[model samples]
Target: METGDLVRELRTARGWSQGRLAAEVNAACGTALTREYVSGWERGKVRPGPFYLRALAGVFDVPQAALDAGRAPGRAGGAAAATTAALAPSVTSDLLGLGFAARLRGGPSADDWEARLDAYGTDYMSSPAADLQRRVAEDLVVVQQQLDAPAMWSAAARLMTVYATTFPRQESARSIQWFRTAAEAADRSGDVGVRVWVRGRGALALGYGGTATGLADLLADQALALTDRPSVGLLHATLGKAYAAALRGDRPAALHLADRARRIFDAAYDPSARLSDYSIPAWRMNGFLSLLSARLGDEKQSAKAREAALCELPERLPRFVTHLELHKGLTLVRAGDREGGLACARAALDALPQERWCGTLQMLMAEIAA
Candidate 1:
């Protein structure tokens, strides 16, 4: 077995294309290797140098000597096959790469791409999920086409994070796919914060979507373990677990988890800082509280949390405002005003654009009706 053969096998075993392999290598070693370079190495047109060999070893999680020996990392050739079977769910099957054609010319500068991603983040806060989904997908095609450098992965990760959030209610399967890709892209960006943030957000999405509370708990626990210091990741993950507990009818556990999340928010979150796509802002934290408390039948706490959330929520984010309103209606129902409460909840839902209704909102609406 040649080194090139081993490299190709490792890449294919992980279901990665030449471009994804290049991204992984670059991310691992801070190198500027491109897909063409990956092609050359895999085809035996050129061998990877010593430095690249080390980088490739890390990317493949194999011993460097395995490449030198031109053999699979473990158990002759069986380990690679075993790894493929074991990690297939995390590994993407998109061999051609995100449905984007590679660009012939250099695309936007790194700073320019960062700015564009930030703008997309802003749009995400204000736009309807269905409307924003199409635009973000289009932008991602452009970003994927120009993903030749490490910095581009950060942009791709951020864009995919926002894109995944748009898919929760309407498209669960697609949501899972994009969330997995977003986490992969975040890992490739070599940013620990981004990696934690993606997982934390995905956990919350799973919980709020009422789809997989067990998976949500797993993702939240993983996010909590990722960092030693307090962070928005920890806060969001705690909140996600709290919501999952509430959904499971574990009232005491849910309240305890919510308390833990509040402490993290108080210690780690800056009250004066602006809202961010990556971090949990004060309003968002309160919004989580509002929904959690409402679901738990804590009318007083739910009303307080709803008031706090509405006070800080930006005018542009009408969806969040509507969420808080739904919480108010839930509180009203929990307080014995069923007729008024149901009407309020239904009216709030009706007032919001049909395209903006998400899984979280729908879940709340169903609870109010019940």
Candidate 2:
């Protein structure tokens, strides 16, 4: 609904240089309308005069009324992507980043595996704001044809991951309600590992919003025992349990588990093991551990973890990875380097350009700013 932001976005999407757009407007004005005029409008720092409105329509490639349309509420244009991204985790592959490939394969190494699993917690629990009704509907139609439990459970895990995000946003009520349905489907598949994985995500979604918080740990614990070592399910269960602990306000216990998870992740560096085959997802582990370390007041450890995460992020695109920048920024602040921290956080924010899904990192920045 913000006309300025919308204009900026449209311009960027079209790959139009601001100078070029300005030239078009100036040509129509029969006089020089400096680029500053356009810049001011895009920055939301100023409104254009009535004379410029007519020219604005031509440059934006839409009718005059369309440019003025929906300007009242602000941010309505940005909402589509934001809402869509917030509604589902699996669908927000840009946010889920690198974890998606591995989840698809369902494997990870003991080293860094737990951290990778833990890191995805934020994306999994928070909704990307999509209406997944159509996809879920399609899935259900196909799911009926899936006689194999493993196939059904695999689909169930993917759907559950998306539903977990949708549940918080209330974007897909049907999908949220059907979480139990998927869980049952997974449970019936008779593979305890799949069952544990799905249940862990369910518990994670519940724990994320602080509802059914107590039971999440119980389910996560169950997932823990069910999964074997060096498994994706096992790693996910560990992170899920740690998050439940964190949510319960037992940071010490959370740290203990987090530490073990980190060690498991570190073991992937074995000289004999190929980093690719070991299946340990470095980005998720770093993202999860770094944020948690920052929260526990372990600045030195947090800084080290976050620094490494930034290095590893180039390979993936999880929305939560942006928070690694936020964490390092905040840790710098706690370390009394306010300027560096601000730069890091601002840069991170700039990279993503929004905080609709980064609740934890947003709060951390807010605290620093306060």
Q: Quote each prediction's TM-score.
A: 0.67, 0.50
- Candidate maximizing TM-score: 1
Tens digits of per-residue lDDT for model 1 on 155-250?
A: 888788778777534334345546657777877888777778777887787676555566578768878887856787777778888888988899
Question: For residues 112-183, what per-residue lDDT tens digits would candidate 2 score against the true structure?
Answer: 323433434433333343334334433433334443445555554545454444432222222233444556
Candidate of highest lDDT:
1
| Runs with alpha carbons beyond 4 Å of true place in candidate 2 | 1-137, 144-150, 166-181, 202-212, 266-280, 315-320, 329-347, 350-370
* Candidate 1 stretches greater than 4 Å from native: 1-102, 147-149, 332-338
In terms of TM-score, how similar is model 2 to the real structure? 0.50
Deviation in angstroms for 129 in model 2? 6.5
